[model samples]
Target chain A: MSGTFNDVIQIIYLAAASCFILGLHLMNNPATARRGNQVSIAGMIAAILATGAIVIHDGLITTTGWIVLLAGIGVGSGLGLYTARTVKMTAMPQLVSVFNAVGGGAAALVGIRDYSTLGSHVAAATSVTTLLDVIIGSVTFSGSVIAAGKLQGIITTAPVTFPGARIVNMLLAAVTLGFGGYMIASPSLAALGVVIAAALVFGVSMVMPIGGADMPVVISLLNAFTGTAVAMAGFVIHNTGLIIAGALVGASGGILTKLMADAMNRSIGNIMIGGFGSGDTAAAIAGPAGAGVQSIAADDAAIQLAYAAKVIIVPGYGLAAAQAQHEVAALADLLEARGVDVSYAIHPVAGRMPGHMNVLLAEANVPYPLLKEMDEVNPEFARTDVALVIGANDVTNPAARRPGTAISGMPILDVDQAKSIIVIKRSMGHGYAGIDNELYANPKTSMFFADAKKGLAELTASVKTLVG
Target chain B: MTLLTDFIIFVLSLWVGFEVISKVPATLHTPLMSAANSIHGIVLAGAILIAASANSLIGYILAFLAAAFAAMNVVGGYVVTGRMLKMFKRRTVPASAQAPAVNAGQNGGKSA
Candidate 1:
């Protein structure tokens, strides 16, 4: 290849990286986020094309290699497109976790192939990157798959722990790092293999003990790992495009992870050590604990909503589980018709992922402006005539206000401040933290025990039929 | 490129990313995350380049898997992220006369 042509190819990679950065910049606002995705798609296409050009120019590939490459592309793109088209909005987080699995898995393979092909003949610097690449990539791969499985109900959403789980986790880390160090010093094929094996197991173990409620943080952390692994692969193969793109994602995922953990008022380390309650509510209700609770009928709840000057709806994972975004949105629409001000209060970690509740609501044709974030919507709860909490538990629990409790220090929706609070829940079943929601017992609150889908639908109906 | 050059590039990109992403609103977190997930799919390029030089049986197998996985990540990540971002729209509610019709005759509320 001519020097200028090679430089041009390099320039294409740079342009592609710039597009990714620009795309992320545009994503800060909702209106431009879609366009941002488009710009990113363009960047990916250009980068892929340039890579194809490089392969053709090098002409090192055999006929078998070409066949393998084409076949991979065909199968991969077809599967990807199929999932992207068919996935339910509720399963978006799982799909992203699956994507992380593949990205991390692929990056690990790159490092593995490079190491085995070169062996001890490789430079120490390159070997260091490859070891790091293989470790992070392999761990991200298996961990993300577990995360996806948990989210998809294939694996239990509850924390899965064993005796000395922490000790076992420590042992795995030691093996992975120890083997990685050995591989760097001597650059042995066996050492690299051990690192890969240990890291894969480490990944699975790392995510296994995590409860479902912490998925938002876990997924983001795994995503950051995936990016860092890709960057290591970039360093291994000396690709500037991979380095820039990987670093950008790594940093962004890091920030998002911090945001999610903060939303739950848990340290990242505390969340990662596992044994926090699972993501779903599975605890049996303590029958006697229901004392002093005010349970409202559909008409009563609807009357409160219909007469309210302002209604704030707080939605959580159960709302998504019951597929009630549309129901809730329709309820809001009905109340708005009667001159009631209605908006959704979205907790950052409300669902399985950050900002996931907003997406679910948006799919139901709820306007973007009506989905207010925690800090922005909390103060408004005071002026709200009725705070209708649909399937939300932890985020609205008043227990988060005080220290020593599981959710203490977690910022909760000020639903308790509303003139009237109605909780739409299945029962007094505990939520993700396995603790009772103190908000349900608040003097201003009433429990409307029902499935979120049916409850929201009923509330909307009652508002239409019973409200004057 | 030298290790130092690569580190420089990585650090600079991280800084650029932090500056851009630091102030993102809560509502865009999911889309932002999905987008960032897709961006790292640039590893697809490295996977393809490796396949270009693969010679042995093991090499071909690894290359095949890498390329396939990377392509899946790139295509799947972007497509899903796009599908999500597309939903973050501001839809104008219909006239109030039609609102009641949307929720009429819904089932009674309360746990069975």
Candidate 2:
């Protein structure tokens, strides 16, 4: 390659990196987030184009190779387009998990292919990265798949465990590490295969114990793993673009995971145990303590909402399951028009993923300022006239305030602090934590049984007639 | 490139990434994760390199699969993120300005 061409390629890569940085900076603010996404897309296009130029100039690809490349592009782009276009907001977590699996699996394949092709001679540095890539990437691949399955309910949303689950998990990790060390020392394809197999099993064991409630943290952790694997793949290929991009993702994901764990007040260690109570209310209600649940009609609930001076709506996975974001938004609008102060209290881990409620609410065209985080909204719940919970369960449970419970020490919305609480739920079902929500049993709280979508629409209709 | 140089670049990039992402508001966390997911699609470059050099059938197959996965990460990530962000428009944006901007972006996106 000519010197100028090589320099040009490097310059374009540097330009792409800068764009990524600028794009992320812009994404920090909601007003500029769309532009940030556009900028990142531009960066991606530039990087791809530059790489293509390099490949063509070098005459590096054969006819068959080009065919393979095009075929891959076709398959990948088709799947991407379909999923991105058609996936519902509630299924976003599952989709993200699937994407993580693909990304991690691909990175692992890159390392494995390169390592296998390198016959007897293997440099220490290269071997290290190759082994790391295969181990981390394979783990991420399988772990993410399991996480997606659990989120989608293909696998039980409740934590799955056996008598010696922790011991088994430790054994799998040890074997994977042992294989990784052996592969690094011998640089043999056979040893590498063992490493990959063990790592994949280890990934499954690691995530299988975690229940549905902890998926956001698990997904974020897997996101970080995917990044590290990509960075290792970068080392294998000697590509700066991969290294920078991968490292960025790794660092960002790691921070986000920690932040999420902190928000729950449960260390990542505790959540990983996978049995944070059955996360089902049936198990919870069947336990030693039982309390009567007061039921209310939609009209009565609407009466409280319409007459209230301040209303705080708490939405959870139930609200998302029934696709009632629009209805809830409508209900809020109706209440606000009747001179009630309506705002949302979004728990950090409300839905399957982080910011799940925010995305759904944003979709309903809810004004951004009306949505408040747990910390910001908790204090206001005291002054609230009514705390209306829609399909929310564990997050609003008063049991979280006491020890010896599944969600003990976990931060909850101060819904119990409100003067009156109206809960809209399908039934007295256990939440993801499989414990009975003490909030439902509180004398001040009344349960209005209905699906989230139907219940919200009914509430909205009732509010309209009562106030106007 | 020397491994030392690469290590330096990797460490520096990690810091840059951490600093940039920390300030992102909670509301945009999903889109942030999605965008980062798209950025890591640079693995496609590595996949391409492998495919170009592959001589055997297994090599070609692995490289092709890797490329496909990487492409999916890139395309699906960016598109879904865009879709999510599309829903986050400020309620304050005047209807007239918003419509034309979206139309122009759609056309620009196709051509670009």
Candidate 3:
């Protein structure tokens, strides 16, 4: 490559990096998130262009290679677009898991291809790194797939625990590690294959025992593993871009997984052991007796919200499942227009994952200022006229902190402290954790049993009419 | 050096770049991008390694610059992300759920 061109490519790469930083900055706020996304994309485009220019200058890839690359790109892009458009919000977590698996799988494949193509000519250090990449990558891929299946309900979300399951997995993981070590020593294709197989089995076993409630954390952890594995693969192949991208993903995913695990108040090891929230234990906590606690209709709920001098809207998994964010926002707008104070009370673990509720609300273009964290908003509930619990169960369930409760000692949103509580839910089914919510039965609480989307739309219309 | 190879590389780069970018959600863009900034470090590492092995001074100089830029990206990216996470923490409810001093309006009375 010409000196000037190389310099330009370097500059472009730097520009792309800057865009990435800007994008991340914008992502902190809901209103600016879209702009952030756009900026990052622009950066990525510049980086790709710069990298392509350099690779071409190296004279390594040929015309045929280029054609194949384009075809692969076309196929991958088509599939990605289709999936993004067709998949429902309810299935988003599963989709993300699947994507993570694909990334891991791709990284493993790259490692394998590099090792096989170079064979003994590759350095001993490179061989070891490659073997590690394949092993970790394969495990992350398979585990992520299982996690996705569980989240999608294609497989049961209950912990598929069998007697001696932990022992069996431990033995398998040991064998996999042994094979990985052998591959590092010998650099043989056969050893690598064995390591891959063992890793795959280990992944399946690792995810199979985790119940539905812990899938989000598992997925995040797996995503981190995938990133680390990809970075290893990048190291083996001497690809700077891949290494950077992979490491970034790995580190962030790890942090996210830790944060999510903390939100659930469970150790990562405990989550992997399975059966923690399974069967009767979960049932005892989230039963229907807890379901029938208290509820009210749309008209009455609207009246409460409309007439209230101060109102707090608490969103949960139900809101996401119902895709009722926009409607909820509309209702809030109506309430605000009517001179009724409206603020969102968001619990850390309210949705399926950490910040899940925030993401959904942000998508609806809700003002960032109105969204209050649990600590900030919980106190307001006491003086608040009404606390609207929308499609949330366990987080707002006062039973969490009440004595003798399964969830006792867990901190929860003090929705119970609100003068009146209006819970909007479809049915009396317990949350994933299977704990009965006492908020439903409180004298001040009333259940508005309807599909979250339908119910919120109705409420929005009612609020509009009332205000008019 | 060939035109066809260059064209192919360009197309492939664009495709990969666009695909990754498109998958990012608005909610994740900031974090993901910040996270991706770590890529610059990878570039720097690669440049340094190549530079060490290269016979030419130009290669060494270019490699050094790349590595330096990438390191900057890594340091800067983490600082921003840390700030963002801190912001998230700030919004959390108070540890104690006790009512504040001023009664904004209603007391903790039950509403039928």
Candidate 4:
């Protein structure tokens, strides 16, 4: 413990921590994000080396223990790599949810291990801490898995509302809290088992009521839960690093969840209990009012866009599904060539996740300068000549800002203020939020019923023909 | 036996690391990296628990080092992620825009 080697380890740990900070800083943009990852990895290497040194210095772990630890690390790293490589872009959200669950599960396991080690000799305070960690961590893990399943489409994305759904959830939560109390008082294996089961049920009930449209907010909220659980586990284990990291995640996730909820003009409580935006209910409510939408062809839409002096493009999940980013970029190029100023308007909650639109557009090699956030582009929409909506619906819906709608008071892209509107969609189906887009029925709007990619291709072809 | 296993584990870990590194898209690199920083918390927790239980000087030193390093990772990782996201907010083209030119070349014609 007093050797020169320990000094080296300490220095390495410091270096690693610095690298992590630097890596995270670089991660905010596409250009340096990869470099940030690399830097952070370098820091991780240093930390691992330091850990190994410290473990060796302690001389507590046997040879068998070391072997098992190494093997576990190897297997875990391999699985992480395999999943990262093979998962598709569409599945990224689910994968993230699962990863968050894993973190929570690991913390819970640590608490369990600590409890078993202490057994009947454990102090009352330690017992309570362990009980809390187990309860929170188990709930986070199970709930996160369910959320992942929903996002991955392995389970239904709609609210699985049944008779007495809210009542059942409330009862389950009450039971879970009771089990936690029992565990704290007795600290028996049976009590722990009951607590775990109750926690699992609570997680499911918490997430099952949420609909797909509110997934972004749901995911963020669940992430916050996972972080808090991890932090509680850290407190039980007396680990400062875990506590700090968990607190950071918990705080950030909580803020993001609130922001997403605000974007939909809903409260987090309503999202959880009311289950307001489920697909069927939302469609039934929002669809009837906007039944007067008019449709048009791709050629006519192309002509409208071509002659416009300025155009704003709004993208959504449909654009992602069709993989139409590149084609949209091509159409934008054509418009710009004709002396039409083209800009992309991005909503914060535009796609499945935050910054989703930026990722899709970046893949198409769209210039970063042309992509404008909601705040930056909303004001410009009033002066715009045209707003070409590509597979976007809810974000541009006037109902978000208009009264008497579910999404009332939520800010939108202001695309309705444009002199003309061309909406490209596959059908009159509502968006994930289950809301009808009033932009479709506007007098200035012309609906083009086609896949975003196909429509953009046709538009590009028509523009070429017209110019030639 | 432990040494042999450790060597094997180290090699396997490196292989997995390479795979993850290669697989992450340019766009996701930031958020994924930031998320990965959470691993530091686990290490720090382990170190601290060991130290607290054992109450040894060596354990305390090791725990402190672990905690400090992990904290650094969290702060630094977020800073980088924030900067990268801000790049998307820029009114100028990202330096990464060179990808389009390469694709245009491959298609044998400049678009627009």
TM-score per prediction, in order, is 0.95, 0.93, 0.75, 0.79
lDDT of 3: 0.63
Predicted structure 2: lDDT: 0.85
Fnat per model, in the order shown: 0.80, 0.73, 0.04, 0.06
| Winning model by lDDT | 1
Q: Which residue pairs show backbone clashes in model 2?
A: A279-A432, A279-A433, A279-A434, A280-A434, A281-A430
**The best candidate in terms of DockQ:** 2
After superposition on all CA atoms, what RMSD does each candidate show versus the true structure?
Answer: 6.3, 5.0, 11.4, 10.2
Expressed as tens digits, the lDDT of each residue in A84-169 for candidate 4 is 55655555567667666766665565566566556556667667767766777778778888888888778887887788988888
A391-457: candidate 1 lDDT, tens digit per residue: 8888888888888898889988898999989888888998877787888888888888888999888
Global lDDT of each candidate: 0.86, 0.85, 0.63, 0.63
- Judge candidate 1 at residue A20 and give its lDDT: 95
How good is the docking of model 3, by CAPRI class? incorrect
- Cα distance off (Å), candidate 4, residue A121: 2.8
Per-residue C-alpha lDDT of model 3 across residues A263-328, encoded as one tens digit per residue? 676778878787764521233223224533655667888888889999999887767766788888
TM-score order of candidates, top first: 1, 2, 4, 3
Ranking by DockQ: 2, 1, 4, 3
- Between candidates 1 and 2, the one scoring higher on DockQ is 2
